[model samples]
Target chain A: MNYRGPGRVRAEEKPMPEILHPEDCIVKVLRSCICGSDLHLYNGNVPDTRVGSTFGHEFVGEVVELGSEVNKLKLGDKVLVPFNIACGKCSFCRQGLYGNCHESNPEATAVGGIFGYSHTAGGYDGGQAEYVRVPYANFGPTVIPEGMDLDDAVMLTDVVPTGYQAAEMGGIQPGDTVVIFGAGPIGIMAAKCSWLFGAGRVIVIDHNEFRLEFVKNYAKCESYNFKSIEDPVQFIKQTTDWLGADVCIDAVGAEAAGSAMQTITGRKTLMQAGSATALFWAINAVKKGGIVSIVGVYGPTGNLVPIGNVLNKGITIRANQASVKRLLPKLIDHVQKGTIKPKALITHRMPLRNVSDAYRIFSDKLDNCIKPILIPPTVKE
Target chain B: MEKIAKGIPDIKDWGIDADPENDPTYPMKPNRTDEEQNGYTWERSVQQAETVEILKSTERPNLSAVFGTSVPPKGLSGAIRRYAYKNSEGQFSHWLPLLIADRVNVVEGIIDDLKKGKVPNIYAEKGFNAMWKYNRKAAIGMIAANVAAVSALGLFLFRGRIFNEGKSVKKALQNYNM
Candidate 1:
């Protein structure tokens, strides 16, 4: 999959990836998925969405070659490569802040290396191809445990960990009312994981009826279409007895499509930092002193946020790229125990050659597509 | 006015000297008689000279002592790895220069605050050290390995491809020992 600028991706054969460092390995990709975040790039929302780069972060594959310094896995090891690249020896990585790895993205002090996101992230090519180079192999690229489905393992690369982190950052206490903004894959997954954190009432808010309905059935959480509600924040506050929800999550980032003003400034005019509408709603709807966990992908530029409310309320806002390497062990255990069905999020699967069509379907939310997976040609059925 | 250190501020400037009394060469008493002034002046000068010498030393800091062994990388390897994977547009074209400017501002801010003799946060100190240290040998090693891997991979990828003969191509391949 070659990115040919905004709204353009071509599925063409490219040079096979090879080990680039003593700690790198070459993986023959089995499966990769199109993330909602990738749509930010497809729609030209993300900065530095370079042409000729492949785009897929959630991937699972078989290691065909190993670097000399890689000591963890043997040849042909089936592995799930985390989206973020991290060196195990970095201060951030040692502290389980793998997503902010100091050794990965020296171009910027903010975001660390991400697979096929953009230059804003470390510009590593993604796994929407026959092969991909896995850096710091021992740190990421966890081997799939026996009997674990490939589809399940693939989601572990990004979605599961991101969703889990969103819920974890919310600091949900028992019987707490947790509301998640957006019914996207991450949003739905966050709602599901909220239950694990002892959320008494889980609510997913979105504008799409299909997604709201999907989350209701899939995550066993109450769902609301914000368009139908009079005012989402007021509604949430009323539902929570006027105190507001204990936790609120913003899973929809820059390309949020709603509110005529935000749509014009963020999506149409390219002013301010992507429509932070969902984030604003999360901030406004959460109870004073409640946690606002954000996993949304915003632009590097500043976003218009209600800082006065944040300051007065003493809300704890925790946001980061999911440190998948840190959470992989526990998430795998959850998957194995059937506590989380990571693959239930998959709504469509197509050959990687149909990536252009797949992107259109998912980006436009056509045919009620919730999540889409790309099967590499090299993978055996 | 504080005596600013006379050196080019690198990416990680940490501190600055503030007191004239801390300088050996600055006169303490100008009107005293030779004999009375000599003894006191000599003593003060010696103490200040030692202090100034300690402050002027330019030894590279040991990151392990401060950050407990998980020291972040301190040189171009971090940047080079990113460059290798990225396309030409994503290279050091725009963002890298901005990052450098940001680092300079942070270091300058640190130096300005150091006049109060207040220790910067441990995280700040660790970050300063990581940015300051020049691990040239490690950087070269990493770059060489990456280049070799890329060249080998390229060769393997297009093994049977036909190419038009050119003197420039021959010279480049010869230079690379291919």
Candidate 2:
């Protein structure tokens, strides 16, 4: 399937991307996952990738080729591509923050520009193609642990790591109240992280009843429908003794409407997905002397923050693109120990040729699908 | 000295001698005949020897000749005496009068000189003090007139109603011996 325009996909043939750098490794797609962000671009919500950009970010694949200088892995290694591209030795990566490496993209941050995005991430084509060239493969690509299904490992590229980062950055301490805004896939994943992180109570808010119900049932978190509730902050406060939640996650990113609920008590933390607007509200909603961690995607233009307010409140803000490499090992351990079931989040699966339909179904929220997996045509059972 | 020179008139003799008590019959001086009052009374009274001495030593014509045929002098003393007193009269009634009027002309000239340019070195060092005396009198007169008009208006309009009430109140209290 080919991405032509917003909600416009057609079948087309194109030359496969080849290894252009010594650190490059070409991966043959085994399975790829559809992200909510991809849906935003697919539905023309994001302006850059509207016309014929390959559209998939979350993926697991096997290496088919490597450049001359590549020595980390041989061909036929199953790996998950990081959502952000990073060179391991840079200052950011040396500090275990690979999302902003210096060399990943000299023009941009080390945050992986997936297979199908625009020029912001070095204009390196994304992984939605049959064959994709991975830059800085030695530092960026992660090997899928043995016996793990490509479908489940695909989420490690984006969703699992992003959700986990949201929870981690949100400061979900033991017995602390965590309020997650938006019941989208990332929001649910954040709620799941809160539960795993031992939050005393995990509350999820969304305007979509179906997604809210999914969060309530699957994530086992308290769900609030913004549409049904007259006042979400008051309602959540009533349960939490009029003191707002200790941590709030704005996983819905730019799509989150209006201002976030103001946190009156405790050390409030806001975990932003990919929205500068969410970061703005998160900055406002946080309590004085609180912390805000922005894991969302920031374009070249920096987000406008009320610097005076942040300074007056002594509010600390930390932001980086999602660093899957740092969180993947723990997530993989959770999966192996059976503490977390990554596959339970998937609601749709289709073949690679039927990718256009998958985009439509997921992008439009048809059938209330959360994470949809696309099995490559060449992959065998 | 010199026997007090009773008939010799000096600079002090150059003035009008109008004595109201001496001429109390009409309260005015009666007009006298040209011969009696010719030249001046003081000139006719001077001694002949002094008149002749003054006339012979002088370079100009005799005072009798300068006075012409209007009134003949009684003698040589009369001529010199008439010359001295007539000179004093001339100083006050004609040229001296013009000199007084010329004081204003000199003041205007000084103002013109100040307006035209800076005071010349010669005038500032020599003439400035004498010129300023007359200028000062004129300036004071102009200033006093302006001040008097302004004060009169102010006292008439402002003090008449307001200050007069205060004055009347004090007067009433004084009448009550308080």
User: Candidate 1: where is the Cα deviation over 4 Å?
Assistant: B1-178
Cα error, residue B139 of model 1, in Å, equals 52
Report the lDDT of model 2 for residue A165. Answer: 75
Report how far off residue A212 is in candidate 1 (Å).
0.9
Note the DockQ of each predicted structure: 0.01, 0.00
Compute the interface RMSD for candidate 2: 64.4
Q: Write the per-residue lDDT of candidate 2 for residues B63-109, one digit (tens) a residue.
A: 21110011112333233333433332212232222222223333443
User: For every model in order, what is the number of clashing pairs?
Assistant: 0, 11
> For model 1, how does the per-residue alpha-carbon lDDT over A309-373 read when each residue is reduced to its tens digit?
89899888888899898889989988998888989889899998778777767876776889999
Tell me, by TM-score, which candidate is best. Answer: 1
TM-score of 1: 0.69
